[model samples]
Target: MAKIKDHPLRYDLVNELHARPFPALTVPCHAVYVAIKEAEHAVNRDRAADRAHLLALLDRNGSPHPQPDATHFSGAMGRHHLKWESHTEFVTYSAFGSGVSSRAFDPMEADVFPQDWLAGAPGTRLTSVLIRVEELPQDEAEMLAKLDDWFVPESLAMARVVDGAAVIAGDFRIDPAGHMRFAVFVKKGTGERRVGRIVQRLCEVETYRAMSMLGLMRARGLSGKLNTLDPQLSQLISGMNSPDHSPEEVLQTLLKISAELESLAVQFSFRFGATEAYEAIVTQRVSVMREVRVEGRQTFGEFMMRRYDPAMRTVKSVDARLRGMAERATRAAELLRTRVDVERSAQNQKLLESMDARADLQLRLQTTVEGLSVVAISYYAANLLAYIAYPVTEGLGLSKGMSMAIMVPVVILGVWAMVRRIRHKFH
Candidate 1:
């Protein structure tokens, strides 16, 4: 039997699903994660530069290069293992090393990514994180004490996740070193892969959270612009029914506002969409952790509700307002156009009436002119005929004056008949 042909990307697509697996990190390890994105047009940025930058870092550590067009790579970089992945709008690098810092959340521990190499990165750092993973202390109190010292009390969120497989905590605040920090306490006997997943999720939560907040900044600016445009649009609309402004003027201004609103929508659409996606990812990452509150402290879910969700809501509100304003402008313009059309119809009716009156007056004037033409022609013909008939009248023994008077009535009747005949033929 012949074997069936396979799809071209059969294995590639299958391999892609497992491409970026969680790093199987043993307990008492730390991970430094950073996500970089271009300052503008990140999705369309030069990906080759991203690859070259990764190669430079790999070179510094004497690590092997990834596949020619690899979107992700995991390799040994000196004492630490490095993982890099490229995404649509950003790229991330994760370095994992054995053992936690002797001094918790220490900046020096992140030296796995050399300062010089990072400085030469292709884009700005979206988020940098230092994750401290450790075996849970025998006494729960010790964990609680560490949490208090490491994170701010008011802002800290700590939770037991995955049915107590581990506990994760973070303040979600950038430290003086400009890196966010998260701590994971692995329960004894938990799988290494499970711990890795937890650590990865922690990094993701922060990265996505920071990325989503960019939408908030965009929203704030958009809101201010909308505020300025709103009154202008309202004023224009309010005058639409008033005589103060012509329909043409109102329509022109409305179109300007509508165009600007459309432009704003276009400009921020991608950013807002990306923010929403990032927000969803952050929520999902936190949810999958299945967090349980620790010491009555806030869970990741709760923290997001208080802080992150509000930012997302604000973005949504701004997007909605922009769309609403555009619609309002459209409605106003439509109304004004209708009014303009009605007014034009009225003016057209008046013009037609004037034309009708002028036609009637012209017809009357033409009739009067026809009558005068007949009379004048008859008088002139009568005199000329009488002169031509002088011989006949002389022979009849009639005077020239008597003959002219008699011919005048006859000539008038003949002229009227001739005029009627000509008018009939033309008509």
Candidate 2:
């Protein structure tokens, strides 16, 4: 059993409560802890102020009602309803809630509680109940049962029993929400067993909450990364059709994708804490090439200075010119590579147009040749026909040569008209 110091009750109530620890009960809402000391005489005049501060905390958090008496302050705080029970020299505050949880004990509020009421000495007692039940032995159940009976249900009390051992227990209700409301009792016995249990429970609950928060943060980061990658992929696909795009552009797009993948991989590694997974991703092969863009003005300025600068009168700037030319040549090479397919397509279109024009010209030439042949054939035929008719006509008084000559011109004109009609029909 730990020793409980007997200081003046007016200056030591908080410390006394600290010496006795309680279980860390999980509450659905928040809860509050208040320690009261018995005040005596003019020495502990600040006890009234202490009570006021505790009530203020409750009121600030939306207490249902206020305490009517100066010695007894009451209000609602967190998950619990509270009342301060004060005597001439001893004071105690009772907290009643559906459940009691660690969140109810705000460290900032505890710091603000009046220390002068305890006579300028800070309370050393563990005022917050953070004990757990799992650390106790089964044989101690009888002792715990005895301590349980001491719980006032409506008041917080502790009485020392015989044999330098005292039992402390609390009646706590587990609500449907898994919140626990405890009427705590502490038997003044070995402090080691009780305090050990309380500390363990508090740590476990805190760890669980922290892990949940981390999980949510990691999920949000992953979602953002995926959204960024989606648009980048679309842009890369569209840029593929541009005639001026280079292999470096393609490589740069791929590199950007790889960079995003690496970022995701890094986040995954941190979330999972898997070094092997990170290493595997890094080992995967990737190729990257990017064009180093030089502004046009800067490039031209450098070329002019190299070709015309008078820094060296005798020396020729052939080397500088070669360097400048090399840079231009490199850019030209990249441009050529990127636009090769487009240029080839344009050349093929021109060739097809030339072929169509040649074919049309050939068709016109063939039609003219056919017309000429028709004219010649018609003239010859007309002449032959006229000759044959000449002998017959001479007996009827017509000349053979005159008929042939006249028919020749008529035959030629008739062939020309027929050819024109044929060409018009086809065209």
Worst 10 residues of 2 by lDDT: 285-294
- The best candidate by lDDT is 1
Write the residue-wise lDDT of candidate 2 on 1-427 in tens digits: 9998866675556755554344333322223343333221122435546556555555556665444544554454564445454433234444434433344333333332334433432222213332222222345545345334533333222222222132222322232322222222233334643333332222222222222223334545555655566566556555655667665566465555655565555445443332222222222210010111121112212321343223221112322332333343344445545565676788899999999999999998998898778877897879777877887878878687777777788887787788878879998
TM-score of 2: 0.26
Per-candidate Cα RMSD to the true structure, in Å, reads: 3.1, 28.6
* TM-score on alpha carbons, each prediction: 0.89, 0.26
| Ten contiguous residues minimizing lDDT sum, candidate 1 | 38-47
Q: What is the alpha-carbon lDDT for the whole of candidate 1?
A: 0.91
The positional error of residue 84 in candidate 1, measured at the CA in angstroms, is 0.9
Please write out the lDDT profile of model 1 over residues 125-232, one tens digit for every residue: 899999999999999999999988998989998999999999999998899998898999999999989998999998888888888889999899999999999999
